[model samples]
Target chain A: MGIEHDTLVAISKSWGLFYLIALAIAATAYALWPSNAKRFEHAKNSILDDDDKPLK
Target chain B: MPQRADAAALSYRDCVSAKIKCLRYYRQQKKRVSRDRVSLLFMGDNDMISQLTSTERQYALVILVLMSLCGLVMAAGGRGDPLGVHGFVVLAFSVGLAFVLISGFYAPQPDPEQQTQYYDDPTKVGIALTMAWAVFGMFFGVWVASLLAWPDLTFDQAWSSFGRMRPVHTTGVIFGFGGNALIATSFHVLQRTSRARLSDQLSPWFVLFGFNLFCVLAVSGYFMGITQSKEYAEPEWYADIWLVIVWIVYFAIYLRTLARRKEPHIYVANWYYMAFILVVAVLHIVNNLAVPISFGSAKSYSLFSGVQDAMTQWWYGHNAVAFFLTAGFLGMMYYYLPKHAGRPIYSYRLSIISFWGITFFYMWAGSHHLHYTALPQWVQTLGMSFSAMLLVPSWASAGNALATLNGAWHKVRDDATLRFMMVAAVFYGIATFEGSFMAMRPVNALSHYTDWTVGHVHAGTLGWNSMIVFGAFYALVPWLWKRESMYSPKLVEVHFWLALAGAVVYVFAMWNSGIIQGLMWRTYTENGVLAYSFLDSVEAMHPYYIARAFGGLLFLTGTIICSYNIWMTVRAGKALATDNDAEGDIPVFARNAVQAGE
Candidate 1:
C-alpha cells in the first residue's frame, strides 16, 4: 500500500519509454500494411445492404 | 477408373465454389430479414451461420495484425519485465490466428436448398446459467457476512467463512451470472436486429471461452491472494491482458456484425452497448497501467504517482461502475423492455440524449470518490457538479423504460419478467438519486468511509443490475429454448418478492448503520477530544452486519428457487415452436422480407 517517491518516479519513466516505442511501431505497421480493395468493397456492401432498396 | 476419379475430383471443386456462393446469398438474406420488422427474430440463427463467410474475413485479419504488432512492440521494448506482456501477446496471437484459420478452412457453404436450422438456443442456456449463479452468489455473500460478524468462527465453518469466498460471491453474480447472461442475450438480439449471423464460429467461442476463463482465474486468484490489490481490477497483470484481448475481439465482432446489419439505422440498444464497450476499454487500459515485476511474480507497480495515481485509479474504478455496470445494463434495458412490452422505444431522441449525457458526466464524477482527500479542491468541486448532473440522464433513461410500459400495467401482474424490469428501473432511479446526494461535499464528510457507500453500491449492483439481469433471463431463456412457459411461474413470483425484500432490508440497515457511524465518528467530547473509539463504530455495525447476512440468505434462497425453476423449464417444459404466444408477439425481421420482395 505504501510506495517510495523515488521508486514511483522510476516506474513512470519506464512507462513513458514503453509508450513511445509502442506508438512508433504502431505507426510503422499502419504504413506497411497492405490495402485490399476487395475487402473494402465487402465491408461497404455489408453496411449499405438495404440502403439501395426502396422503402416499403 | 482413372477417368471417373478425375471427374469426381472436378465435381468436388465445383461443389466448394457453389457453397461459397450459397453462403453469400444467406448473408444477403440475413440482411433482408433484419430490415423486415416481422422476420428479425427468425433471422438470428441464419445470420450466425453466414458469419463464417470470406466476406467478413478482413475484420478478423485486421484484428490479428494489430494484436501481433502490439505484441512485437512490447517484446522489442524489453522493459526488463516483458514476460507478462509477452505472454499476453502470444495468447492474443493464438486466438486471432485460430479465428482466421477457422474462417478460411470452414468458408461458409451457402445452402442452395435454403433450409434454416435453429438449435443450441443461447438465450435459454444464458438464462439458466444467470439464475443459477445469482443464487450461488447470494448464498456465498451470506456466508461471508456471517464470518465477518462472528470473529470466533473458523474457516472450517462452511457457511460462516468470510475470508476466502467474498470475491466468489461478487464475481459469481457480476461476471459469471450477470455478465454471461448479458453477452448471451445481446448476441441473440444483435444478430436478430442486424439480420446477420455471427461472423465466425471461432469468435463466439472465443468470447464465451475467454470470459469464463477470466472468471475462473479471477476467483481462484482471489483465494490464492494473487491480486494487484486494486478493487475490481483485482486480477493481476496476466488476467488483465487476457481481458484486454477478449474485449478487443468482442468489439471487433460487434462492429463487423453491425456492418452486415440489414437495418438502415442502428437501434438504440446497440448504441448503449457500444458506449459500454468503448468506455470500458478506455477505463480498463488507463486504470491498469502497471508493470509486473516479472511474468511469474505476483507483484506489480501502478505507473501513476501520488495524487495522480489516486485520481487515475478512482477514475477507472468509478467508471467501471458507470460503463460496465450501469451503461451495459442500460443497453439491456433498451432491448428487453421494448421487446417484452411489444412496443417501440418511448423516444429514440430521449435515448440519444441520455446516452451522451451519461458518457460526458460520468467521467468527471470519478473524482468525487476522493472527496476531502489530498485531491485538489477544484477537482472535487467538478466531480460533485458532474455527479449532480448525472442524475438528469440516469433518470431520463429510467423514465424512458418506465414510460414504455404505459397502458400495459396488466402485463406486470401476469409476467414476472416485466415486473422485474419495471422494478429495476425504479431501483435505478433510487440508486442514482442516492449517488448524487452522497457526492455533495458536506454529505460526503459524514458518508465517506462509512457503511453508507456499501449500501449505495448494493442498491446499484444488487437492486438495479441483478433485477434487470433476472428479468432479461426470464424473458430470454424461454424464447431462446423455444419453451412455451416456465416450469413454475409461482417460483418466479416468489423469487422476485423475496429478493426485493431482502435487498430493501439489506440496504436500509446498512444505510442506518453507515449514517450512525459517520455521525459518531464526527462527534466530539466537550474538550474537543474524539468522543468514540473506532471500536465503538465497529460494535455499532455488528447488528447491521448480522441483519445483512440474514437478508442475503433470503435473497440467496430466492435465487436458488428461481434457478431450479428455469432449469426445470428448459428440461421438462414443452417448447414453443415460434415466438408467437398469448403475450404480445412481434417478430424482429418481417420488415426486411417486405423490402426484399418489393
Candidate 2:
C-alpha cells in the first residue's frame, strides 16, 4: 500500500516548489500592497495606547 | 448547594489566610505536584467562582470524568504492563482536576458584563504552570548534566539512568516550560491584538490543561522507560494521539478568536503563532504514524524503515526546532519585544518579508540534520543550501528586533527585562549563522556527531528560547497580575548575568571540547593509522563536562531565583490589592460606527 520513493520525490520536487513559491509571492504582495499601508500602520501603533477598553 | 460550598468554604478572611499558608506551603510542595495557580485560583475570593459560567464548569467536569474513566480502563486492561502505571497516573491527574471542577460546579454564572472584557484567567494559570515546569524541567537538566560529569550519580535505580532522564529534561523544558509560556503569551497577545476575548471560555482551559497532560505523559513515560525512541517524538502512540487531540482544540481556539477580531488586518505575531501551531500539527502527525502491537501494549512500530525512516525522523526533528523553538518564540518576540520596548516594530515590511522567508525556508532545511549519513547526497545538498538560505530570514527578524530598540537604548540599559530580550536577539543571530555554517558538507563531517552540535542546540535553546521566555514573564507577570513590576528588579539583573554566564560557559566549553574530540577522531599517526583511542577522547572530555555542569547549575540557580521573584510578586499583588496597573487591551469595535470587524 506504500507509494514508490522516486514518485514521491519527483512530485515534491515539482509541485511542492511551485506551491511554496506561489504562496510566498502572494504573502509578499499582501504585505506591500499600497492601499493596505494605512491598516498596517494602524496595527503597529494599536498596542501602545491605554485606550483599550471595550465599547460600552 | 454543593457548588456554592466552594464559595462558602473560601471567604475573604479564609482566602487571605490560605494565601499566607499557601506561600509557605508552596516551597515544600515543589518536589511533587501543587504550588501552581490551581490552588491559588481556588483560594482567591474575588471573582472566584464567577470566572466560569456554570455550564462551562459542568462541561469541564463531564470531560474530566470521561477522561478519568478512560484512564481507569487502561489501568485495568493493561494490568501487567508499564501502560498500567501510566493509566493510574492519568486517573490521578484527571480525577484531581475533576474534583476542582465539581467543587465549583454550582457557583453562580459569570456576569454577562464580563463578556465585554478580555478573559485572562487561563493566562494567569498558564504562567504559573510555565514556572512550575521550568523548575521541574531544569532540575532534571542539572541532574542529568551532573551525571555526565560524575557518571556515578545514578542513585541505584532503573529510572535514574541517563537514557531515560535525558528525554525527561528535553521534553520538560521544551514542552513544559516553553510550551506553556507560548500558550500564555499567545492568549494575552491574541486578545490585545484582535481586540477580542477568547471565543469560548471552556476550550481555552481545555487546551491549556490538555496540553499539560500530554507533557506529563511524555515526561512520566520516559521515567517508566516507555518511549517510541524518536529523538523529540518519543512518547509512544497513545500520548502522541492525546497531543493531536489537544493541538486541534488549540488551533480551533486561535482561529475562532481571529475570526472575531476587531482589526482589519491580522498582526504579525499571530501569523508566527499560527505557523507554529499549524506546522507543528503537520510535523507531529506525519512523524508519529505508528502501529501498536496490540491494543493494550505501550509499544509501537514506525511505518517507515531504513533511509526513509532516518529522513523522516530528521525532518520531524529539525522542524520541531524550527516551529516549536524558533517560530513560536519569534512570534513572542514580535509582540513582547516591541511592547516592552514601548516602540513600534522597526519595520512592518521587514516583519512581513522575514515571516514569509522563514516559513518557506525552514520546511526544507531538515535534511541538513542527516548530512553524511545514509540519506541521499542530493537531498543533503538541498538541505545544506536551504539552511544557508535560512540565515537571511533569521537575521532579518533578529535585526528587526534590535532595530526596534533603536530609540529605546536607554531602556535596554536601565531595564534588565528588555536586556534579556536584546541578548536573546543577539544569540538568535549568532546561533542561526553557526547552524548554517555547520550544516555544510565539510563542516558536517567534523561536527556531525560531536559536542559542537550540542553547543549549537544549547546556544539556541538556552540563549534564545529561555531568555525570551524570562523576558516575557518579566513583562507579562506584572501586567497580568496588576502588579507594578517584578517583586525584585535587582534579582532580574542577577538572573540576566547568571543566565548569560551559564549559556556562554556551556556553549564555549562544548565548542572547545567538540573541536578537540572531532580532531582526535580524524587524526592519524605518522604510520597512517588512527592516533587516539575513543577512550582518550572521552577522558579528554572530563573537564569540559564539569564546566558544562557548573554552567547549568548557574542557569538553574537563576531560574529558581526568578520563580521566587515571581511568587513574591504574586504575593505583593495580593497585599496591595488596589495598587493596580491599568486594564489595557485592544479596544473592540463599537456597534454603530465604521463596521471594520466585530
Candidate 3:
C-alpha cells in the first residue's frame, strides 16, 4: 500500500516547527547567558597561543 | 641533551649552557624512560614510521595483513566481475603498505617524550596529499568543463565518457582534496585549541590513509562504471562498509582527544568540526542504505525508491553540502582567519549562534531540492521558509569572520595569504545568499536544472571552500615545516588574482547562459504555445560553455602554480627550529621546559 501523505504532512508542519523553535531559543540562551561571558572571552584568545619551540 | 640547528651559530659558552639547560629539562620530566633520553631531544623531522614504537609498528602491519587477506578472499571469490578488479586493487594497496612497514620495522623505537609534543606527522603528509589531490582533481575539473563545450574532446572510450569522468572530478575535488584539508587542519586545530596530543598515534594514520582508500575506490569505481547511482555517495557497498569502519575510528579518535582536552570549554571551531563528522556519519549511513544483489556482484538496489528516495537523496545531498562543504570549511575559517590576522574572532557568542542556527535550519532545507516535484506542496514551502531563514546564520558566520578584520585591515592589504581568507569570507556571504535565493519556488522555476545550479555550486566550492583551504595551507606550511614563510609571496599573489578571475568569469558566464535558457524555455508565443525547442536552448549555451571552460583552465593553472610553489618550499626553503606565532604551549611540561631557560 501507498503511504498516508496527509497525516505525515500534518505532523511535519506542526511538530517540526515547534521543535526547531524551542531548540533555537535554548541554543541562543546558552550562547548569550550573562554568567558565561567570561568563559567565552577567554576561549576567544586561547587558540592564538604559540606552540612550544624545539627544546633549546 | 642534544644539538640544535642554532647551536652551530651560537658562541661556544652559550651552546654549552643551552645544552645543559635542555638536559636539565629532560631530567626533570618523570615520564621519560632512560632509553628515551637522547632520542627525545632528536625528534626533528624523522621519517613517519621511525616515530612509532616497535609494538605500534607491528600492530599496523597486522591490521594491514588482515585487510590484505580480506582483499585476497574477495579476489578469489568475486572472480570474473568488476568486484574482482576492486579486490585486486585493495590487495595491492595493502601489500604495498605492508612492504613499506616491514622495511621500516627495524628502525629505533620513538621516544616516549613524544607525548609532550603534538603529533604532526599525519598532518604533514596530509598536507602534501591535499596538494596532490588539488592538482589531480582540478585537472579533471578543467577537462570535464572543456568536454561540456567541445563534447567530442575525450578519448574514444567509455571510461573517458562524461558519465564516468564527472564523478571522478567531483569525488576527486570534494573527497580527495577538500577532505584531506579538513582532516589535516582538524588535527592541527584540535591539538592547539585543546592543548593535548592526539588520543593515540596509530589511529590518526588509520583515519587519514583509510579515508584516502575510500576516495581511491570511489573514483576508480566510476572509471569502471560501477556505482549505486547516488550523487556524492557513489561508491559501491563494499567501499561504503569500509568507510563506516574508518569513520568510526575517526569519531572515536576525535572524542578521545576531546576527553583529554586541557580546556574547560570545547572551542567553537571544534563544535563545527564535531558537527561535520557526526552529521556526515548519520547522513552517509542513511543515504547509502542499499542491498547488494549478491556477495560477489558489484550491483545493488537502494532501500528507498520513488519520491521517498528522491527526498532521501536530496536530504543527503544538500546536507553533504551543509556539513561536509560548509561546516568543515567553517571550522577552518574560524581557526585560520583570526590566526592569520592576529585578531580574535569578532564575537564568540555569534559563532555559537551561527553554529546552532545552521545545524538546525539546514536539515529541513533539503526538501527545497525537491520543489515543484511530485512531493507535496507544503513540504516545499517549509523547505523554502527554512532555507530563507538559513541565510541569517550563514551570513552571521561570514560577517563575524569579516568583522574580525577590523583592526587587521592593513594585514589584508599587505599579506596575500591573509587576503585569500578575507576574500573567502566575502564569497561565503555571497554564496549562502545565492543558495537561499535559489531555494525559493519562483527562483527555482528559473534556476533549478540550469547552469545556474552549477554556477551556485562552483560559487561555493571555488570561491569559498578552495579559497579558504589555500589560505590555511599558506599559513600552515611554514609553521608545520618550521620555515620562516612560503617559498614565494609573489607567487601567492599571482595565485590569488588568478583564482579570483576564474571564479568571476565562470560564474558570470553561467549566470548569463542559465537565465537565457530559463527565459527561453518559459516564454510563450502569441497564441500561447511553448516558444523554444530544447535544441534552441542548447544552442544558446554553446558560447558560454566555452567561456566557462576557459575560466576553469585559469583556476586549474592557479592550482598547478600553488602545487609547484609548495613543492619548492619543501625542497629549498630555509629551515628553522620553531615558529613564534604564539607564546608556545601552555601545557605543564612545556611551561616547565620554558622556565628551564635553555
Candidate 4:
C-alpha cells in the first residue's frame, strides 16, 4: 500500500523544519566566513562616517 | 659710499610696503561687511531655510499653487459632494502649505555648512507631525479609558460614544503617530546607512502630505459613521484607494533611494523598512478589496464575506501590528539605539538572522488571531507554530539591542533618550513572549475577547513603540535644529519617570483586570452552572477600568512634557548656537564622528 496520508504530512513537516535549519546555518556560515570579516566590520562602522560634510 | 646709499633705499621701500599692506587689509574688511549686508536681505531666517533642490523648488511652487486651487474648490464645495470633512482638512493643510511657501520667499536659504548633506527637512516635518499626533492620540486614549470607567461620560451623541471614540484613539495612534514616526526615521536611517541623499525631494513631501490626507479621511469618515467594519482596516473604499496610491509612492521612494546607495551593501535597517513598506501595501490592498455602494457614498461591502473575510481581515490586522508597529520600530531601534549609544551593533549576523526569521514567520502567524474562530484546525496550528517560532527572532532583536549597549551602559544612565531605547527593547522582549503564549489555543480560549489582549497591545505600543520613538525624537530634534543638547535634561528625566510609571501601572492594571475577566468568563459551578453573570464581570472591571484611565492620563501627561521639552529645545537652538560653534566643527549630535582614515 501507499504511504498513509498522516505519514506524508509528518514527512512534509520535518522536511520544512530541516530546510529552514539548513538555511539558518548557511546564513550563519556566510556571516562568519573569514573572507567576509573585513566587509562586515566595515558595514558595522559605516554609520560613524556619516558626518555633516558633503559626500564626494 | 654707493653701497650705503643702496641699503638706505631698500629700507625706505620696506617701510612703504608695510603701510600699503595695512591699507589693503582694511579695504578687504569693508568689502566683507558689504557682502554680509547683501546676504542678510536674502536670508531672513538663517536657521530655518528651505533645503530643497532646484528641481524640488519647482515642485514646491507647483504644489503650492495646486494646493491653493484645491483649497478654493473645497472651500466653495462646503459639505457638498467630493468635499465633506475631507474638504475642510484639505483646505486647512493647503493654508498651511501656502504659509510655508510665503515664508520661503523671505527665507529661502539653506545653511549648507551646518545642515546634513541629505534632504532631512522632510524628516524634521514628519517628526513634528508625529509628536502632534502622539499628544492628540494619547488624549483620545485617555478619553476612551474614562468612558470605559464611566459610560455616562460619552455625552448623548452616537459620535461621542465608546464605539466611535475607540477607533479615533486606535487610528490616531497607529496611523497618525506611529506611521509618521516610521516614515521619518526610515528616511533618516536609510539616508545615513546608504551614505546617499534621498532619490528626490518632491516624492518625500508627496508621501508625507498624501499619507496624512488618508489619515484625516479615515478619522473623519469614522466620525461620520463610515466604515468597512474591519479592525485596523476600518477606512472605507475611497480612503483605502488613496492609501494604496500613497503607499505605492512610499515604496517607490524607498526602492529608488536604495538603488542610489553609495555603499555597496544594503543596511539591515533598510531591509526591515523595505519589508514594512511592501508588506503593508499588500495587506492594505488584499484586505480592503470591496465594492462601494455608490461613487458618492462612503459605505462599501467587503469582497470576501463570512469566514473568508474574517481570515483576510485578521491576516491584515495581525500583520499590521507585525509590520507597521513591530518591524518598522525594530528598524528604528537597530539604527537609533546603536547610534545614540555611540556603539556599533553588537552582532550584524544576529540582525540578519532575525530579519530573515521575522520576515518569513510573521505573515504565517496572523491566523493565530483567529485561533478559535471558524478557521480550520490545521490553519490555526500553522499560525500557532509560526508564532512560537517568531519568539526566536523577536528575542534576537531585543537581545541584540541590549548587547549593543554593553560598554555604553553609562550612556543609558546619563542620557534619558538612550534609557528610553533600552527600556523599549526590554518591553519588546516581554510583548513578543506574551504574544506567542496567547496564540496557543488553550490560552486563547481563556484570554480571547478579553482585556488581556488590550494590555498586551499597550505593552507593545506604549512600552515598546512609543519609547523608541520618544528616544529618536529627543535625539532628532536637537540635531535637526543644530543644538548641542536638549533645552532641559531634567525634563527628559521627568518625562522618562512618568512614562515608566504610567506604562507599569497601565499594564499591570490590565493584567489584573483581564485575568479576572477571563477567569470569570470561563468559570462554572456545580451542575454545569455559571458562577458569575456577564454583567458581574463587567461590574468587577469597573475599578480596573478607572485605574487604566488614570494610567493613560499619566502617559498623556508625560507626552505633553516631552512635547514641551522638544518645543523649547528648538527655540533654544534658534536663540544661540551651541557645541560646534567654539571650534567651528560640526556638532557631535548633528552626525557621528568619523574615525581617522575611514
Candidate 5:
C-alpha cells in the first residue's frame, strides 16, 4: 500500500506541474486579450503621469 | 436698430442652450433604458440562468463526466458513501456556477452606482454571520472541554460525544468564522485599494456561497466520522475540491482587481493577504493529495505514507497555522491597527523583512511536530533550528505593531478594538517565544504528549487568532453598518478583561500541569524502575482541567457579550452618511460625527 501510494503521489506531482503551466498560459492570454488592450493603454498613460508628479 | 440687435443676440443664446439640454436628456434616457434591459436579462428571475456562461458550462460538464468516471471506480471497489452528500453539493455548486456565468454574459455595461451596493450589503451579512458562528464555536468548545473532564465518561461515550463536536468547533471558528471575516474584509480592502467597485455582482456571491458550502460539508462530514484523519486537513476529497474551486475564483478576483488598482504600490496589507491566499492554496493541494475510493464515500487514501506522509502532513499543518491563522491575521493587523489608531506603520522596512522571514522559516518548522518519531533525526534538528530562528521575524512584526502605537496610547484606552489588536500582538510575541522554546530537544522531551502543547496552541489560537479576529470585527462592524460607535463601550471593556484573564489562567494552569505530568512520567524509583503510574499523571491533571474549563468559560462568556454588542450596534446604532465618491462606502465614525454636527 505504501509503495502504491508513493507512485500515485509522483503521478499527482507531475500532473500538478502541468496544470500550473496551463493556468499560467490561460492567465497571460486573458490579460493580453484584445478586450483588455484599452485598459492596458490607460494604465500605461497613468504610469507616465506618475513619473511626472512631484513627491508628496 | 440697437434694441433689435440686442434681442437677436439673446434669442440665439437661448436656442443654443435649448439644443444642449435636449442632447443631454436623450443620452441619459438611452443609458437608463440599457441599464434596465441588462438588469432584466441578467438578474430578473432564475439565478441559474444568470450564472452559466458557455465556457463555464463546458467546465461543469467536464467535471460532471470526470465525477461519473470516479464514481464508477468507487463502485468497482465497493465504496459508495461520498455519492450522497458529495453529489448534492456538486449539483448545487454547478447551479451556482451556471448563474454566475449567465450573469456575467448579460450583466449591465457597468453602472458604478448600482454595482457598488450589490456586494456591499451582502458582505456585511457575511461578517455578522461569521461573528455569530465564532461565538457559537466558543460555546461548543467550552462544553466539550467540560464533558472531557467528567469522571463518569466512558471512552466510547466521550469519543462519540466530543470527538465529533471538537472538529465542528474547530472548523466553525477557523473556516466558518475566520474564513468569512477574511473574505468580507478582503473584498472591502481590495476595492478601496484598487479604486474600483467589484467587477461583477454574482462572483462575490459565488465566492461567499462556495466558502460556506465547504464549511457545511467539512463540519457535517466530521460528525459522521467521515474524515481523512489528518489533523487540520480532516476534510475529505470532495470538500477539498470545492475549496480549490472557490480559492481559484478568489485568487482571480483579487488579481483582476489588483490589475486595475489606482494605487501605485500594492498596500502592505494586500501583499500579506495575497501571500496567505497563494501559499495556503499550494499547501492545501499538496498535503491533501488523496485518491477517493468512491464518489459518495468518506474513505480515501492519501498518496504519502510513513515518514513521507508525516513530513507532508506537518508541512501542511504547521503552515496551516502559519499562513491561514498567522499571516492572514497579520494582514488584518497591518490594515486595522493603523486605520483605527490613525497612525502610520512604524517601519515599512521591518514589516517587509519580517514578512519574508516568516514565509521562509515557517515551512521548515513543521518537522518539530514529528520530533522523536520515526522521522529522521536530522529533519528534527533542522525543524528545531528553524523554529528558533523564526522568533526574529515573529518578534520583528510584533515589535513593529507595538511601536506603531508609540504615541497612540490614548486610543488604546478608549478604543476597545485597538486594545484587542495590541493584546493580539503581545500574544503573538509570547506564543512565538514559547513555540521556539518548545521546539528545543530538552524542552520537547518534557512538553511532547503533555497538556503543554494544548496550552501553546490555545495561546496562538485563542490568544492570537481570536483576539485578532475580535479586533477585525470591531473595526469592520462599525464601518460596514455605517454606525458611529459600538452599542456599548463598557461591554467591550468587560470582554477584553475577561478574554485576557481567561487566556492567562488557562495557559499557566496547563503549563504547570503538563510539566508535572512529564516529570512524573519520567521519574524513577531509586532502584531504576518507573515510579509513577500513568494514572498518577492523569490524577494530577484533574484540578488543572477544572481550572482550564473555568478559563474557557470566561473566554466563551466574553465572546458571547461581544456578539451581543455587535448585534445591537447593527440594529440600533445611528447611521453615518459621509460622502465617499471614489469608494462609495462611508467611514462609519466620520459619518456619525457629520450627522451630529448637522
Candidate 6:
C-alpha cells in the first residue's frame, strides 16, 4: 500500500522524469561495469591503430 | 700501414673526400623523395597510384567537350544583356569544369596496381570547397553586418541588397562551408571508426557535387528574389527536389559503408551521424511540400497556409539546427576531440545515453519554437517539457567531452587544436542551456522577436560550430598533406585568440542589444501607452550593430589567417623536402608516419 497521487501532473512529475533518469543511470552502470572495460577500450583504440593512414 | 712521412696528409684527404660523397648522395635521395611526395599529394596515397581505365578516360573527355559546348552557348546567347546573371554564372561554371576535366585527364598517372583502395578524391575536393566557401561566406557575413551598421552600403543594387545577400551569407556558411565540412569529415571519420572504406566511390562524388549544385541554385535564386519565404528552407521547389535526390544517395552510401564495418559495436559517433542524415532527410522533405508554378520557373507556393504553415516552418527550422548544425557537428566533436586529446572517451556509457536522449528529445523540442502561437496548448507544454529534459543529454555529451580531457589538460593548454575543441564543447554547453530556458513561455515572451535569439544562434554557430571546425581542419591538414605539423603553431595561437575575442564580443553585444530591445518593446508609460516607439528601439540598436560588425571583422580576419595557414602548410611541406634542414621542419605527425604513437 504505497501512497497514491494519481493526477496527470503528479503522475508525470513522479514517473516521467524518474523513468528516464533511471534508464540513463542503468545504461551508465552497465557500461562502467568491470566486464565491459575491454570492449570500450578496444573501441577507443581502434581509431589510433590506423592513425598513420588516411581513414580511407 | 706504410708509415710514410705524408701519412697524416693522405688520411685527411681521404676523410674529406668520403664526407663530400656522402653529402652528395644524401641530397639526391632527398630530391627523389620530394618529387614522389609532390606526385602523391596530387593523386592520393600509394593505393591510388594507378592510371585511369579506358572508360574513365573516355568519360573525362566527353564531359570536357560537353562543358566547352555549354559554355560557348551560354556566353553567346547572353552577350551584352543586362539581365544575364544566370547565363554568366552558368557559362563561368561550365568553363571551370572544362578546365578541371582537361587537367585531370592530362595529369600523369602511375601504372595500374593489382587492387585499388578507397577513393579519397571526393573528400579532398570536399575539403577544398569547404575552405573556399568559408572565406566567401564570412566575407558576405561581414558585409551584411556592415550593412546593419550603415544602411547606405546597399549601393541601391537589387543583387547586393541586404535582404538578398543575408541568405547568401547564411546558406553560404551553413550549406556551403558547414555542409561541405560535415560531408568531408563524415566520410573520413566514418571510414576510420567503422574500419571500412566508403562502399562506392561514385555515389559519394555524386552526393558532393549534387549538393553543391543545389547550393548554387539556392543562392542564385535568392539574388533573383526567388523564394517560397521559408527560413533556412528557402530553396525553390526544383532545388528542393534535387536535394531530396542527393540526400537519398547520401543515406544509401552511408548505410552501405556501415554495413561493411569491421567493428562489432557501432561507435557512438556513427550513431550521431546517422541521426543527422536520417532526420534531416525527413525534416527537409516534410517541410518543403509545395506546388511549383512551372517546370522552368523558380517559384512555388507552400502547400500549407496560416498557422499551420508557421508551425511547419518552425518545426523544420528548429530541427534544422538540431540535426543539420548540432548533430552532425557533435558527431565531429565526439570523434575528433578524443582523437586530438589522445584519450579514450571518459564514459562510453554516457555517450550512448546522450545520443538517445538528444535524438528522441530534439524532435519534440522543435515545437517549442511555435510557443505562444495559435498552436494547441498541450503541444506547447509537450515542447517545453522536452526542451527541459534535453538539458540532461546535452550536458551529458558536453560533460563527456570535458571529462575526457581530465588527464590531458596539459595538451589542451599547449595544443591550439585541442583548445579549439574544448572551447567548442564549453560553448555547446552554454548555448544548449540558453536554448532550454528560452523555450519556456515566460522567457520566450521577452526573448522572442529580439536580438537575444540572434545572440543565441551565433553563440552556437560562431562559438560551437566554427571553433570545432577549425580544430578539425588543423588536425586534418598536416595529415592530408603528409606534413609534420602546421605551417606555424604561432599563427594557430594567434587565430585562436582572434576567434575567441570575436565570438565573445559578438555574443555580448547581441545579448546587451537584445535585452534592451526586448525591455523597451514591453515598456509602457504610466498611462498604459507604449513608452518607446518601435523606431526608437531600432535607433537604440546602432551602437550594438556597429559592435557586432567589429566582432564579425575579427572573426573574418581569423578565418582568413586560417586559410592562409593551411595553404602555406601544404606549400611548406614541399619546401621542407627540398631545403637543407629548413627552420620549419616537418611536424612529428608527418615524420613519425602517425600522430601520437606508442
Please state the interface RMSD for every predicted structure, separated by commas.
12.7, 4.5, 5.7, 3.3, 12.7, 5.7
Give the poorly placed runs of model 2, Cα more than 4 Å off.
A1-21, A52-56, B1-38, B41-49, B574-598
Off by over 4 Å in 5: A1-56, B1-112, B115-119, B151-159, B577-584, B589-598
Per-residue alpha-carbon lDDT of model 4 for A15-45, expressed as tens digits? 8679778877887788778897777778877
- TM-score, ranked from best to worst: 3, 2, 4, 6, 5, 1
Misplaced by over 4 Å in model 4 are: A1-26, B1-50, B53-55, B61-83, B95-99, B102-116, B574-598
What is the C-alpha lDDT profile of model 3 across B34-126, one tens digit per residue? 434323222234657888889889899999999899898888878998888889989998998898788779999887767778888888878
Compared with the real two-chain complex, what DockQ does model 2 have? Answer: 0.47
lDDT of 6 by residue, B361-407 (tens): 78878778887888877668878989999999999988999999998
Q: If both were scored by DockQ, which would come out higher, candidate 2 or candidate 3?
A: 2
* Global lDDT of each candidate: 0.70, 0.85, 0.85, 0.80, 0.73, 0.78
- Reported per model, the fraction of native interface contacts reproduced equals 0.00, 0.59, 0.45, 0.34, 0.00, 0.27
For model 2, residues B1-598, the per-residue Cα lDDT tens digits are 8666665655655557656655654553453234455465323223444578877787888999989998998899778988888899899999998877776677777778778877788888898899999989988998998898888898888899999999999999999999999999999888888888899899988899999999999999998899999999999898899999999999999999999998778999999999999999999999999999886889899998988888898899999999999999998999998888878998898899899989889888999988778887878988998899999999999999999999889989999999999999999999999999998989998998989998999999999999999998898877665544678999999999999999999999999989999999999999999999999999999999999888888899999999989887766443312211233332211111222221
Deviation (Å) of B27 in candidate 2 = 24
Q: Give the clash total for candidate 1.
A: 21
* Model 6 DockQ vs. reference: 0.19
Best by TM-score: 3
Chain B, per-candidate TM-score: 0.79, 0.90, 0.90, 0.86, 0.82, 0.85
Model 6 error, position B418 (Å): 0.8
Give a tens-digit lDDT track for model 5, residues B161-203. 7767788778888888888878877787666545555665546
Q: Can you write out model 1's per-residue Cα lDDT over B295-362, one digit (the tens) per residue?
A: 45546888988889889989988898888888889988887777776666665556766877787679
Please report how far candidate 1 places residue B116 from its true position, in Å: 5.6
DockQ of each: 0.03, 0.47, 0.41, 0.32, 0.04, 0.19
Of models 5 and 6, which has the larger lDDT? Answer: 6
**Candidate 3 deviant stretches above 4 angstroms:** A1-3, A53-56, B1-44, B577-598
For TM-score, candidate 2 versus 4, the one ahead is: 2
Docking band of candidate 1: incorrect
True-vs-predicted CA distance for residue B333, candidate 3, Å: 0.7
Question: Residues A1-56, candidate 2, lDDT per residue (tens digit)?
Answer: 48776886788789977997898788789889999889889988886654444433
